[model samples]
Target: MQQDTVLVVGGGPAGLAAAANVNSAGYKAVVVEKEDVLGGAPILSGYAKLVPSGEWAKDAIGRMVKRVEDDANSTVHKGAKVEKLEGEAGNFTATLTNGESVQAGAVVLATGFTHFDSINKPEWGFGTYEDVLTTTQMEQMVASGKIACPSDGRVPERVCILLCVGSRDRQIGREWCSKICCTVSANLAMEIKEISPETDVFIYYMDIRTFGLYEDKFYWKSQEEFKTKFVKARIAEVTASGDGRLLVKGEDTLVKRPIVIPFDIVVHAIGMDPNADNPEISQVFGVGLEKHGFLERAEQYTNTCGTTRKGIYSCGAAYGPETIDDSIAQGAAAGGRAVADLHALVQKAG
Candidate 1:
């Protein structure tokens, strides 16, 4: 069994960053990713631009992937899922679905979150209507450099965006804010307007929860420069017209009246849900889960990366909703901690 190696589950942004740091600290790291690719949702979903910095998502996340791949001490196992996890902190064994096993001194679970399936909300007409799509699907359209209707491939004259599709809704049992949805939605709107300025964009939301200093740069710029209309109301329902257009039914809460708008396409700003693998990973690592189903930290603030089980840590969306920058920072922090712990164990054994 390997003595000083680290097993990093889920080769997303956080996992790749963690592996890079771990390898830099003189420890071998085995990154196990269920998907064939390394960048997780951002890469798999075809995200074009990253928020705030507006850098290409591929370039930003690709650099981290390159760092991991370049490191000789870091090994990436693509298309591999953990089948079984046994042993304790300082010496854990992970068996992959590919019938391979690896032993490590510590474990880092960076399994990222899943997007809220818009299909669950049947009223949104996600799967039913050809023109209705989620933000991820819209990203693909934008990546193609043509924001056109899915039904006929015609340039859409009007586009409607519905925010908070699967988040902050008590009826769906997800009450907490998904954190990044609001900002991402706004960014998507700006992208749409950039590609097609003549296409009028309307964002329907309960509230524009753009946190931090984005008030001037991103959110405000979208409204003022891009002319993206922000509607302060939740969408009641979305119906499809016979001609392939969408009839968005919602209220103008500001004006206290019901408004029905017709658009060529409607985009749902979906939120993040707990990773489907949380339960399996929790059982495998012997870690606890928060009520909301994210990996439980020892403490919310002081111990964001420490799981209930020592030597097994968590970061990124696997821990909670956070930006990519924060996830990278947490990954580095976890890597540093794992190295320190392993060093102490080696010294004690000697």
Candidate 2:
């Protein structure tokens, strides 16, 4: 017999939104999360204030987790993953790693993207120097209410944020932009200034893509109000200075000259990469992956969230680098689509 349930993989913002929507539609939602907690990168990485909304990741994503957990129709499996999927649309059985089997009419893959590892680009001084950190690491520092250097307890007088650490670089083979890195870096700059007013923040970038509403909100506001410096430059490498400070070597494209700047701290605005488990997810769910290793969408226009498999849908960063708000919206849409399909199947059976 077909079940009135939707199986949602991953427990990030997108997965929570999908489960909540499904439960609201009077259908059961089985959420399978590999981690013990419901929240994804934001909670796992300990993010501070999110972009656009400016809400704390815990509060924003916490509400989503609460919504899903409160519903009686929703069943969440923590520290478990869907090991195998059998059967077909409207009659699917998913075996979990935790020894649970869920029967569902549809599935929604909301597995999010992974943060680009800064270790791959060692010249940037991530693993080499404790003062050099990723955006996520900086966010953790901001959340902790401290902006001191990891190497030493001293507060940094100058911090340089290098944009597109693992993005738009043919050498790394990550040609796609990570979408939110620019705006996020701008927001981070403002936050750093707010915390430590005396510290000057410089952002080195190829292009400032604040894009649409974020231009005035994050990029322009950061420069005008917070005095965050925006430099059009290509960073070559980050090395140690004679005096123990970090030297950022790069070319100022605007002036057409190479320059080496010294900074107390260097921040790498890392990009988003395809989920590490995309291969396993593709194999278990019988779905296809696009060239970038993200879950392939069946059709962009007609089936916005549908995967290669008929009863399985996908949304959020699983498709590509997506914003949290967009991911939630896509998750809700995918949930609605799955519910509608299930309803149609029920009608046909009747």
Candidate 3:
């Protein structure tokens, strides 16, 4: 009965979507992002092209940003982290590190995910070999134009793609599937073939998990049309050659023999992690985390975004693995749910 303000935290695709709805419904809502700019991981992501559906993510997020910018009711704060969050349902206050505070009746936490640094997986020879690179590094390089091997400065004669480096592995903390890696790697392989048909491309994966839709088609196309080679195996190690080439050692599990493949460049399709500050976010908002470290929602169907805490909700990778499209969807859903709760409070006040 006091006030109705909903705070949306994070400015990624999901956060942006959530903010749009929160503003449209005439709720006093603000979006708080820790970065200097609004967009979360995708903004800094080096992906050459968007994933699954292959929509340029920058362009997609650009449209979402414009919506937030045009809506006068929506307030966006860049370069700020919620240092403290307090209060209960229909009343919460977020204290920012920059000495600013945002009061709200509800809070939507959309803090996104972070990439696993390739260097952490030393067995991939990421740091030791100049030719070895992470998928992010490859995207950045491809974006820069000439896609040449870092080792020899030549159009790579052969390229090797390793999947599930940080993802789907129990050795690393991330045991669950990151979901997007296989498609992205396959797309990059195709792009490499398109650019230089002469160069050989090999993808070593334990299982080629093309889950649905056009992605499955793309996987098939890579095999039939592009002639991209696939090896169903788990890589053992990557050793560097004196002249900057890389030797990838893995067992072709299907064949039951050790296979050593050499290449001018080696790319590690690294997985994702909860945003580095996930624990901090959990502490600040008083939300619980899943065993896998994502936000644990109160209920799957009824409260897609609402947390165990009364006034706080979570969306996007803060909750778990999601595609750009799903993140946007979840964001919008969270926004509507929070606004509905706040609106009910407003109605009672009236």
Candidate 4:
């Protein structure tokens, strides 16, 4: 068993950041990631391509990986998860299925999150219609340098974006904004128009969320400036015509009329929520979880990472909805809190 370390779980933006911060504090850190590789959500987060910055999440996460690998006080475990964690506070042991356990003074949970599967709504015709694709699939297509209609292999003349398929609807269990979908979908719409100027793009949304700095400008630019069609309605279903085209049926609430539009390709910009199995992690640490299964702290203030159980801390998506910047900041904070907890324990022992 490895001794005298902080076991930072999950190796994405938050986990790696926590490890980096803890190591810099003169304490060793061990990062346990379930996947065979690091980078967390951004590992598959193809190309929402960073906003205002014009960089992708993949590029930014790459930089974080280098920092952690180069640090001597940090050890990375790919394809490893703590099947069992024992003891508490100043002395804890995490045993992996590989029959290895590590002794650590502190723990930080940064497990991150997963995306919604848009195909659950068969009416959207995700798998049924070759012209229909989910946001992640669209990201992959964009990254792969191809945007042809999946069925006909021709440059799409009309591309439609369907919003809230897996988000903000009571029919399905996922009923949250997913925080980043609106911006990402809007960003992609503009990018698509830029790439294929001849292609007509339409964005269907219930409400255009334009929070934070200059986000409204982005929404406006995509709608009015870029001439992307903005339809305020809830799409009921997406079907395919006999000729390999797609048909979308929705209610245009603004005009209060039922509308059916045909397009060469349709993209589903689904929303996201907490991971399904996050409750299992919460139970392991004896921490409180929000109704949505995200880790819940003491309040909105002092107990962010601190759990009901001492010596344990949680951050990033393990806690709740937050952006990349917020997650990194919390990771660094969690490291400080944990090191402080350990320093006090050492002082007591001496």
- Candidate closest to the true structure, highest TM-score: 2
Ranking by TM-score: 2, 1, 3, 4
lDDT string for model 3 (43-132, tens) is 667456676666665776778898997888888888988999878788787799889988888888898888888777888898988888
**Clashing residue pairs, backbone N/CA/C < 3 A, model 2:** none
The TM-score, computed over Cα atoms with residue i paired to residue i, of candidate 2 is 0.99
TM-score-best of 1 and 3: 1
- TM-score of each candidate structure, all chains considered together: 0.96, 0.99, 0.95, 0.92
Per-residue accuracy of model 4 over 104-162 as CA lDDT, tens digit each: 98899888877777767888888787788887778777767667887768999999888
For candidate 1, the lDDT comes to 0.86
Candidate 2 wrongly placed segments (more than 4 Å)? none
Please report the candidate that would top lDDT against the real structure. Answer: 2
lDDT of 2 by residue, 200-281 (tens): 9999999988887999999999999999999999699999987889999999999999999999999999999999999999
lDDT ranking, high to low: 2, 1, 3, 4
- Each prediction's Cα lDDT score? 0.86, 0.94, 0.82, 0.80
Clashes found in each candidate (C-alpha, N, C closer than 3 A): 0, 0, 0, 0
Which portions of model 3 show Cα errors greater than 4 Å? 1-3
Each prediction's RMSD over C-alphas, in Å, is 1.4, 0.8, 1.7, 2.2
Q: On a 0 to 1 TM-score scale, where does candidate 3 land against the true structure? A: 0.95
Show where candidate 4 strays beyond 4 Å: 1-4, 214-217, 348-350
lDDT per residue as tens, model 1, 1-350: 46689889988888888898899988999999999999888898888898777888799889889999889998889999888888887888889989999999899889989889998888988998999999999988888899999899888899988999888988888887888777887788899999998898888988888889766677788888888988898997899777768899888999999988899999998888989888988887788999999888887786678899988888888887877777888888888778778889888988
